[model samples]
Target: MKYLSDQMLIEVYHRAVDLQLDSAFIELLRSELDHREIRIAQVSA
Candidate 1:
């Protein structure tokens, strides 16, 4: 699960950087990533 989460984060980061998403969209993606990380931590705990 941790590995998958890390992979997802990397993908999101790449998309944000490579695609040059607008600030608003990037912020939204960051929010989603934060939520995913929280969920993963909860599940792991």
Candidate 2:
């Protein structure tokens, strides 16, 4: 179970993607998500 709602998940993932300043490397990760909200147990920067 997650504390965040669907919209929150979307927002969080977008924020994570935004932090990927390494534009070249981020392409693959972002493409994998494909504009979908990800439900991961935890994300570590």
Scored by lDDT, the top model is 1
TM-score result, candidate 1: 0.47
lDDT per residue as tens, model 2, 1-39: 156555665565566656854655455444444545454
Alpha-carbon lDDT of model 1: 0.57
Task: Give lDDT for model 2.
Answer: 0.52
Instruction: Quote the positional error of residue 31 for candidate 1 in Å.
Output: 0.2
In order, what is each prediction's RMSD in angstroms? 9.3, 9.1
Tens-digit lDDT track of model 1 for 1-45:
245565677576557656777777766656666867633222110
Q: Relative to the true structure, how large is the alpha-carbon lDDT of every model?
A: 0.57, 0.52
lDDT of 1 at 33: 66
Q: Candidate 1: give the clashing pairs.
A: none
